[model samples]
Target chain A: MPIIVNLDVMMAKRKISSNELADIVGITAANLSVLKTGKAKAIRFSTLDKICEALDCQPGDILEWQNPAEKT
Target chain B: MWNKHRSLKLSRILVLCFSVMIFMMTFFVPFVADWYEDVSDGMGLIGGSVYVPMMVTLYVCEGLAVWAVAELHILLKNISKGEVFIERNTRCLRCISWACLLAGGVFGVMALWRFLLFLPAFFAVMFGLIMRVLKNVFEQAVEIKSENDFTI
Candidate 1:
């Protein structure tokens, strides 16, 4: 839970819908939803590569780490 | 191919027949003797030849179902972790496995009941133990699904 996916935030900043990203990344909308919601345990390198390429951003921009106890 | 489907269909029919035999045992075996108080008059007549063949066939069919379910679980786990991608999955297969487990348990209990009736209580406990194993596996399937949204 400490490793958070900031995909939705990044998607909003870049003005991309989850569906559209799913299309660009060649994955299903549901999977994209998982990543967006931070429910995914891990992301495949191939998918991560595609996502970064599609969004024109680095992986660091999409993934943020926070200690659970430090949550606001 | 149609031929492949035909062979699969035949095997399915055979499995169904075996299931029917088990069903017969569950229903009729009870009337023949109470599940427990009949306990040890050497009950539940599954005769040697019929018993061996039924056990073999059930073993094979159930083995296939178990293997498929296990593979499906693994695929689901991978999908959850994003290590795999799927176009679709076997919802039918999962449903069939659950049905098989329940049905198999019931028939086994009915057939064995006369031993405890001739032998019922301890037999039920044995069946309970088997049920627990099947339940755990089913739960693993469920965990894989919940983690994978059952079908995402």
Candidate 2:
């Protein structure tokens, strides 16, 4: 939960729609949605590779880690 | 041909049959007790004196047996529907295990009056222990399944 997915931000910056990104990433729209909404528990390296290749970005660009204690 | 579906169906049917048999035995307790008394008369067992207590114990055990069988029916239904490793099945197993243990406790107390009753009490406790272990396994499986489902 501390690891946040910034997939939607990266997707918006790249001017790609969710369906188009899902098509290029070879994953279902629901799973893409799960990633975009930060509901996924973990991401596979293969899936991360596909997403980075599709979005022309690094894994760090789509993932962020924020300390839970910092929120308080 | 025999398959998983047929096996589950058979298990459900057996649970149903056991339920019905226990239901019918509820009404036949007095007659059965009288017959038992007659048979035990020559064996030096406590005959007519323990009739009322024996009937009460038998009814209680039957009620617990019905509870356990009904939980088993639901569990089998869930498995037949491809819903194994879910929380509901664990709950059903827990209920069935508790029912078995409670019936065992009842039987154990009755065994003080009739030593032969200890056999059934021992078997019931053993069954309950097995179910409890199964429930623990299911709980762990359900947790892992949930983690896996959300891992995507």
Model 1 Cα lDDT, one tens digit per residue, A1-72: 798888888889999988899999998998888778777876788988998999899999988999888897
Indicate which candidate wins on DockQ: 2
Instruction: Give the lDDT of residue A12 in candidate 1.
Output: 90
lDDT of 2 at B8: 82
Candidate 1 steric clashes: 17
Off by over 4 Å in 2: B38-48
Q: For residues B11-60, what per-residue lDDT tens digits would candidate 2 score against the true structure?
A: 88888898889989999999887776556533224443657767888889
- Choose the strongest candidate by TM-score: 2
Please, what are the lDDT tens digits per residue for candidate 2 over residues A9-62? 998999999999989988899999988888888789999999999989999999
Model 1: residue B85 alpha-carbon error in angstroms:
18
Per-residue lDDT over B1-152 for candidate 1, one digit per residue giving the tens place of the 0 to 100 score: 57854655565566566655655654443343333233334445553223333344344435545554454455445544554323233343344445455545544544542333323334434544565565556566656756655222
> In candidate 2, which residue pairs get closer than 3 Å at backbone N, Cα or C atoms, i.e. clash?
none
